[model samples]
Target: MSAELRRELSRLDTLANALDSQFRIPGIGMRIGWDGILGLVPGVGDAVTLLPAAYLLYKGHRLGARRMTLMQMALNSGIDLAIGAVPLLGDLFDIGFKANKRNVALLRRDIEARIEEVA
Candidate 1:
C-alpha cells in the first residue's frame, strides 16, 4: 500500500478503536468504547456518535471505494443507528455492533482488493 493509504488506514483504525474498543471492562474483560458510553444517553447519544461514522463513509468515498462497498458501509451505520436508538438493548448492541470498526474493515478490504486488481 502507498504511504498515504497506509496513513489513512492508520487514522481510520485509531478512530474505530476509540469508538468501539478503547477500554476493557473489569473482571469479565469485555471491551467497550465511546460509542457504548455515549449510547447510554437517551434520545441523542446514538445521533451524536453518528458523526464519526459519517466521517468514515466520507473517507471511504474519498479513498475510491467501490459503490457497493460504500453502500454496505452505509448500511452498517444505518443498522447500528436504527437499532442503537433502543433503550437498554441499544447500549448492549453498541458494545457488540461496533459500526465504525466494521466500516473501517470494510473500507480496508475494498481498498486492498482494488489495489490487488491493479497490480
Candidate 2:
C-alpha cells in the first residue's frame, strides 16, 4: 500500500479503537469505549455515536472500498444503531458488538484485496 493509504488505515484503526475499545474495566478483562459510555444516554446518545460511524463509511467510500464492502459497513453500523438504542441491554450489546471495529476490519480487508489484485 502507498504511504498515504497506510496512514489512512492507521487513522481508521485508531478511530475504531477509540469508538469501540479504548478502556478496559478493572479486574474484568473487558474493554469498552465512548460508544458504550455514550450509549448510556437516551435517544441522543445513539444519534451522537452515529456521526463517527457515518465518518467511517464516508472514509471507506473515499478509499475506494467496493460497493458490497461499503454496504456491509453500513449494515454493521445500522445494526449497532438500531439495537443500541435500547436501555441497559443496548449498552451491553454495544460493548460486545464493536461495530466500528468490524467496519474497520471490513475496510482493511477490502483495501488489502484490492492491492493484491493490482499486484
Candidate 3:
C-alpha cells in the first residue's frame, strides 16, 4: 500500500481501537473503550459515536470500496446505532458490538484487496 493509505489506515485503526477496546476488565480479561463509556449518556452518546463510524464509512467510499462492502459497513454502524440507543442494554451492546472496529477492519480489507489488484 502507499504510504498515505498506510498512514490513513493506521490512524483509523488507532481511533477505532481507542474507541472500542482500550480498557480492560479487572478480572474477566474483557475490554471496552470510549464507546462503552460514552454510551452511558443515553440518546446523545450513541449519536455522537455515530459520527466517527460514519467517517469511517465515508473513508471506505473514498477509497473505492465496493458497494457491497460499503453497505456492510453501513449495516454494522446502523445495527450499533439502533441497538445502542436503548438504555442499559445499549451500553452492553456497544461494549460488544465494536462497530468502529468492524468498520475499520472492512476498510482495511478493501484497501488491501485494491493493492493486490494493482499489483
All models: lDDT?
0.94, 0.97, 0.89
Q: Give the TM-scores of the predictions, in the order they appear.
A: 0.98, 0.98, 0.93
Residue range with the least summed lDDT across 10 consecutive positions in model 1? 38-47
Per residue, candidate 2 scores C-alpha lDDT tens digits across 1-119 of 99999999999999999999999999998999999999999999999999999999999999999999999999999999999998999999999999999999999999999999999
- Give the least accurate 10-residue stretch of model 2, judged by summed lDDT: 32-41
Candidate 1: where is the Cα deviation over 4 Å? none
Per-residue C-alpha lDDT of model 1 across residues 1-119, encoded as one tens digit per residue: 99989999999999999999999999989899998899999988899999999999999999999999999999999999988999999899999989999999999999999999999
Each prediction's total of clashing residue pairs, residues at least 3 apart in sequence or on different chains, is: 0, 0, 0
Off by over 4 Å in 2: none
The top-ranked prediction according to lDDT is: 2
Ranking the candidates on lDDT from highest down gives: 2, 1, 3
Better of 2 and 3 by lDDT: 2
User: 2 or 3, which is superior by TM-score?
Assistant: 2
Residue pairs clashing in model 1 are none
For candidate 1, give the lDDT: 0.94
